[model samples]
Target: MAEFSDYIVYVDESGDHSLTSIDPDFPVFSLSFCIVKKDDYTRAVVPSVQALKFKYWGHDAVVLHEHEIRKSKGDFTWLLTDRARRKEFYEDLNQIMVDAPITIIASVIDKLKLTARYPRPWNPYELALHFCMERLLMFLTSMGQQGKRVHVVFECRGKVEDAELELTFRRIVGGANQWGWVSRDFSVMEFEPKFAKKSVNSTGLQLADLTARPIAIKTLRPEQPNRAYDVILTKLGQIKEFP
Candidate 1:
């Protein structure tokens, strides 16, 4: 089984709420979690990523669209599609998941629908990102209370143009101590954006993307129900209950 330790966790997001800023559509956001094992951080994450540099051209390496995976070879194709290969990959991944002790919490909002029901004070993207981060931090706190030290690293959402997103994230982290998301005297560090982008292309981010896609699709097809949530939850197998 994988073992836990003091590790660096990386995160990234996908999709935007620009078009929906006025008349909201689907406000989808993703949070990917990846951790570098204390002992094998360099070998496991850094080198593997460096090897994939040749394949980055003309492909959506970050978001990883399904169509592109269907056209690739080696790691990308095996990990993204090809069910048999994915099953084997997960079997191996179980060890890493247990050892590195990682989790990703992604939350999305169907903005057009949500605003129509209950309006929010901030932009949908900003609100959804903060909400997801809050839940993620809450989960981390609960894990820490169980005696785990987690160092969270996030890919900055570029230089935030919207002051609300900046303000909200600052407030959330600053007030974490007051809100019990952090212990009475614990400190959390945020890392630079590119560090997360350089992390391994693990299933965590792909799974988060999977979770967000259906929500985004549902905004246009209100008649359709989101089944990706259940599909991904089943695949992850660790998330028994979602908040």
Candidate 2:
């Protein structure tokens, strides 16, 4: 059997918490995750994403615009909009999807409700981030039941007391171990802002931001089912929309 180190999981986030500050009418907050196995990293994900860029922009380069992919606008829209090309693109994407082991998780938050619940004027981005990380950890614990260890690599939010995040992660990991959800020696590694940028592009982060947009739009009429869209809604207070 392959060891957990034989695979790599990279995670990232999208959208700004201060959308209301920019455009008070259109506030959106979102978090996203994108996971890939180690062997598939070089063989499938990298090449397929590069192909996706080429197919969309007629050039092979690293594309980082979340709105382009999320909104399917501009060239991205063109690629998916074109019938023959869209078929080819989806074919390639399906091949990559089948070849690689991947999973995506996201949470969307309604900022107005979040403010009413917390009312501390704290950094909403950080709050949403912690919620994303906690849920990701929980999912990994549940998936590790097949005697497989999970190695997680996530982008770090540049904050002073982020050490607390590490400590909290360890505690949760310990609890998962006690429950036999994971082995006693699993590990997590966080990347600096620079390296994270060069690593895998996170689609989950983009999805999270997208999920948050609608809820923020519907702040005047919030519903309970909207809260259930996110996995961390109960703990974080009606902030996330999950898919």
Candidate 3:
């Protein structure tokens, strides 16, 4: 029996949900759960991230978004022209990831395989989320806290998708869906899963965003170099790959 901590998981996704426009180079849709103790995020992680942001942009209003940072666009535009600054900032960012007390649970959807398996496929995002929940249940069971509670924080996209996702989660957790009634040994999560929105100032969601792309890159190209994934490998709890 393992002791459990009061944890919250922040979920962020990478890659496209559209089946028609699937990029061959990156066909996988990925979701990453950036989990930390509730208080640790507020105490250590939040302050540390704010300091890092201030060091680069000199303002709290400026936030880190993965696409912008990856392409060096948006507030990161200067990174495109300044190789030295880009290198420095990336290194510092990597170090911050290394120091943060967090864990990642990743789910990857293989779009090519998914299409071949189904006449019409489930939403890739939902598929990945389901896989992550299975692992989350197992993780909690292993911790000897089959009755412990945990909350999940998701980034807000829009009302329609959000409402749909909430329904999906409830079905999954309540054994109203496939992942539930079928798996008797892992019947239910340690606790009934709770959810909340990612605050604008949330550093955990930002961390989750940073993790999503590198994981997509690594899953699509296992032979390729991926130092970003390496930084979190020790902290990665479970990585689920779906058809």
Candidate 4:
């Protein structure tokens, strides 16, 4: 059995990776990896998110999904009735993010330019994953986590997608990437990927989910006033905007 690293990664994506029909408003796909040390995540981040949930919903079961929160749907319906409460909710959520000790590495891919440049463009999600994995290895190496197993948690997206993603992840770890550097030789870190349901309400996954869309919006419209992105920016360790 491999010794575990002190850190873990949670991944989430924003926007559809499909190129068949793109939404005019959003044409980019963004993938975010939220890396947090195990101790910090359990000691601080988990409590903070739970506190917020308890204060708002009286329970810790509600998942902090960006789309549902934005649309004031289901568990977030209270936001629709009270505007001041809505403002307060956002403020609280932003404070949690600002205080959390998370290292964010992301890839935002512009599908329009990608399709234009390559007659047969690669899947944006796979491309983003490749980029993120390379950076993740670099980060782990820098943190002196070589030869340790680091678990990466991802939201379950059904059987076929999960199987495909697992294959892609293994291939990347096997060194079939743009850099051509073997993971064992260069990175010296063993990656363990797991699929999780949102219902599990993992704090790391929820944070990653909140992170992805704000990044996509910022990349798509840099000049736009994005308070959420402003808060998220403070936590970003590295971000790549792909051509």
Candidate 5:
């Protein structure tokens, strides 16, 4: 077995899994996994992001969230009214994404076409989770870290929903089916998934959330100019979206 680092993969979602709430123009669901070594996350990623927040607001309590930054809402009210400052702060955060020591693996589901093509399609969240986990394991394998285990941490929706998500992830890890059989052999992720709300102060989840929207935007609006996303496109895995 290959050696592996103790790592944590944080997954944050952009867009919804609800077929009913599908936006005709942007009907895509995206889940992004930001993988980092446990030690590096604490010694590097966390403090770096903290510095960025402090640089802007001079406060440690402020968190970096993509949607909130874009709309300039919530704790980011100061940024809302100041276009120049917001633009500068946003650029610095993107630099953090580039310089951070991590890997990005994501799955984007084209919900509008998925439901149309299949009368009974697979659940979007579950589908994305399956593919993302596979890619993460593959990444470990490629690095010759087959023996190192990775755990997935998801942003919570609620107690009930979070429990359901955890169960599904455990089942997947158990290799309950054909795909599971492959994961079982790889043996990279064997731990039960963790679900903590974003308010729990997880820098990893914050990073994942920051990256998820740019991915959704690129997938939903290919024609639009998105230089920020272009900067991180190289990190995206090769998993294709479902039809």
Candidate 6:
């Protein structure tokens, strides 16, 4: 009889994993895991995001995508017309992220350095996933959640990408990772991967989406002021940077 964990983790990524033609502006690939207790997710995070949507859109149908909001495209087009509303919206949204009782574990891969070092480098996404998943297990173990079943939610990329990610995730969680041992007591936490489409409007996935870029940017340019990253630092539990 396996018991479920009181926490759920949402995953999102920033930047493409492709080593070829890396964007000079944002060369790093980052994966963010937003871990939230079920109670806090239900009682705080969801309502706040929904309220923010309703306040501006008069409905909650609008998904909170980091790219869309930043670019004022898609459902966020109106934001471009009204600077005051946009500023207010951002302020409120930033406050919500700061106030949310969530833990973020992120991994950043410097693709430029990675390709420069290795003749044959592993896929940046897979490498970052491995790092985050290992730390995720460690975080769960620290919280006395060993043997507990925790669901990790990831936004679906495409069919092939999603399939590959799922496979990699299962392999790591099944103890096929760098640390080859599994405890008899099942001290390693069990994680079930759940994939949701981007249109699903998941609060956790959105929060994870909002976090990935900031962490990646901070890693790439530590001196640059990132207000979003500053807010995210409050919830950051662990951050891993890889060459």
lDDT of 6 at 119: 94
TM-scores, in order shown? 0.49, 0.52, 0.86, 0.96, 0.90, 0.94
Please give the CA lDDT of all the candidate structures.
0.43, 0.47, 0.79, 0.91, 0.79, 0.88
Number of colliding residue pairs in model 6: 0
Angstrom error at residue 2, model 2: 15
Q: Encode model 4's per-residue lDDT on 61-125: one tens digit a residue.
A: 89999999999998999999999999999999999999999999999999998888888888898
What are the runs in model 3 whose C-alpha is more than 4 Å off?
A: 1-5, 144-148, 179-181, 184-199
Q: Please give, for residues 21-83, the per-residue lDDT of candidate 1 as tens digits.
A: 643343444343443344455555333333333344433345443334434554366565567
> Could you tell me which 10 consecutive residues in candidate 2 have the lowest summed lDDT?
189-198
> Per-residue lDDT of 158-238 in model 5, one digit per residue for the tens?
988888888888777677554333454534535547788777878888888888888888888889998767766866665
| Candidate 2 clashing pairs, residues 3+ apart or interchain | 30-208, 32-204, 32-205, 33-204, 108-241, 109-239, 229-242, 230-242
Better of 1 and 3 by lDDT: 3
Judged by TM-score relative to the true structure, which candidate is superior, 1 or 4? 4
Q: lDDT for model 1, please.
A: 0.43
Candidates 2 and 4 compared by lDDT, better number: 4
Poorest lDDT segment (10 consecutive residues) of candidate 3: 183-192
Model 2's lDDT to the true fold? 0.47
Clashes of each: 2, 8, 1, 0, 2, 0
Rank the models by lDDT, top first. 4, 6, 5, 3, 2, 1
Ranking the candidates on TM-score from highest down gives: 4, 6, 5, 3, 2, 1
lDDT of 2 by residue, 103-200 (tens): 55455555665566664644555555555555555555565523455555545465543465455455544443222233433334221212133234
lDDT per residue (tens digit) for residues 118-201 in model 6 = 898888988888778777777788888977889999998889988988998887766565433342222366678999997788
| Better candidate number, 1 or 6, judged by lDDT | 6
